[model samples]
Target: MYDSLWKALKKLPLLPRRLNYAKAPALRFLDLPEDIVYEIVHHLDIRSLCNLSLTCRQLYLSLLIPHLHQQKLPDPFREIHLNGDNCTAAIPALRLLLYDSPIKAFTWRAGHDPRTLVREVEQLRRLIARMSAIEYLELDFSNNWPANEFRHGHENGYWAWVRLATNLLHVVAQRCRVVVVTNHYQVLVPWVTFIGGVPYNLDPPLLARMCAEWRASAGEAEALGSTKLMKSPSKISLSHPDNAPASATFPQPFPPEKGSTVYATRRLIVNDPGLFQRSLFGEWALDWVSNMPLTHLVIHQGRMRLPLLRQLRLPRLTSLVISHG
Candidate 1:
């Protein structure tokens, strides 16, 4: 009788009890300022940060996109690889990624179209200007210069490349510690050598133009009393002796008297074999390197003769590498 009564009583509600439940609102993670959000995620690893970015679009922009250059991450951030296809489209993102970012290296791979080379270089120049001081910059222009192709319509392309090359070097010398510039093209026609000892695309005229622009800029820097990286009594005079243009006399090599300049660029690399040919600008190249405060120098697939090597007098040069054919 007691068990039956207990069971029956459990099935029946004798009195209704009053209960209270509280419901708090959800936290808005994106409402915080950018700096504060960065602080909160400072301890997060790259994977965790990536996961958090997927939670919302705003978080994706704030966390993942801007933090692409985080030092803790792998080479994707520390080393930026760019080609002709992604150069212009990646500017805005790169601006955010490069600002105050510890990016150490940059590489640009160009295509074979001579017409688009200059325009692409302009875009590249813009991106480089935004980057912080970096360790290495590699510009591979091998495809842009084909020895036997586009012979009739390549002169304008050559000049455009020369001007842009000059400007790019100026920007790089200040921002990069080491730069490797390569333009490897095989000579297809033996008779082409009769023109200038090299192909038409990379002839003495183009080299002279590049050297002249460098001298012009150095002369301007001298006139402005900016002797930081360029100071030589025999440095290209802005005013020619006979009132002729400076470019007229730019073909001549520098005097044997050596002068040095302190530049942020500590190392240089050239990968073109015919670039410093004696018939080309071998002496000019020697004089140029002897003047720079370079700690390291490398010339790959070059024709630097033993006599030319003897002429190299770099007081601060600690390492040298030469690769001949």
Candidate 2:
């Protein structure tokens, strides 16, 4: 039967000659075994792998394999710094790199001019809006000329620049889990140390007034015995540059209330002794610290009242460091 079938096929005029195996086109890279292709792709850096994925649908689909994709991607734990002369021009590249990356920490340096710095911050805001994985952000004003002036109480367009910085922080905080404002190269420092520009001579009087007002208000509220009307304790601290012993206290005892949401800071460092001495406009310099999510706290050369310390709610705090002057 096989012989008859072969003979009948040979009689057909449309039948072509059998092709030689040796003349067949060489096997392409895509034709290779999937395991071999994946092995080759695994050695590629993230940028190269991303490019390869864009070449065709097949390569793109291959990269979607759970194990291979995880191996080729960059580690999100490492902190990414954006600074230098070309940072403005590099925004697009930065955005591309961070778009899908699990990077959680970012540091941005604001340059010298206010206008140029605003533009840079705007670009960054756009970038952060698209990156939901970012948990920490630091805005460095150490390079900004006006920031230095403000820190020393020189006051040459300092207020305007500070307002810009504050506005930027407010916006960034909405997207970031931890937002930091710093003039030094270091990322996190005590709230007082960040406000070093306040006048030294006025520190004592300003602190005295704040303490008096706080106490008087507390007494009045306590007399009424209205729990709903009572104000939550504010974390306040103050010190003099001259090393004069300055302190403030609340008239009422403070205890951690039940059911209150506590935000934990991962790291807090207070290096300046005179940080909380003066009022930041009408507010205590370090009043903002109470609202932060504090996990690790370090106080160096600064002082905290016993009442304020007790009132602080740091449920996630694991490390505490304190040093006296």
Best by TM-score: 1
For candidate 2, the lDDT comes to 0.45
Q: Could you give the C-alpha RMSD of every candidate to the true structure, in order shown?
A: 16.9, 17.3
RMSD of 2: 17.3
Q: How well is each residue in 1-325 modelled by candidate 1, as lDDT tens digits? A: 9999999999997786767667787868777787889998888765567678778877867775556444322344577777656554443345444346535667787755545655677767766766656566777666544444545443333333433554465556546666667665322111122122222233344334433443334323311112232322223333433566655663343433443433456667766665555632445556555655677776654443556677777889887766552
Stretches of model 1 off by over 4 angstroms after superposition: 1-77, 91-98, 144-153, 185-262, 278-288, 309-312
Task: Name the 10 consecutive residues with the lowest summed lDDT in model 2.
Answer: 222-231
lDDT of 2 by residue, 1-325 (tens): 9999999998989867787677767898899998998899778665576577668877765654333324332332345566645445445434544344434567676654434655676677666655544455555554434334324331233333333333343334334444444343111222222332322222344334433443344323312110111122322222222343455332221222332423223344443344333333113324344545555555443443334455455667676655552
Please tell me which predicted candidate would have the highest lDDT against the true structure: 1
Clashing pairs in 2: 263-293, 264-293, 264-294, 265-293, 265-294, 265-295
User: Could you estimate the TM-score for every candidate?
Assistant: 0.51, 0.39
Candidate 1 lDDT score at position 4: 100
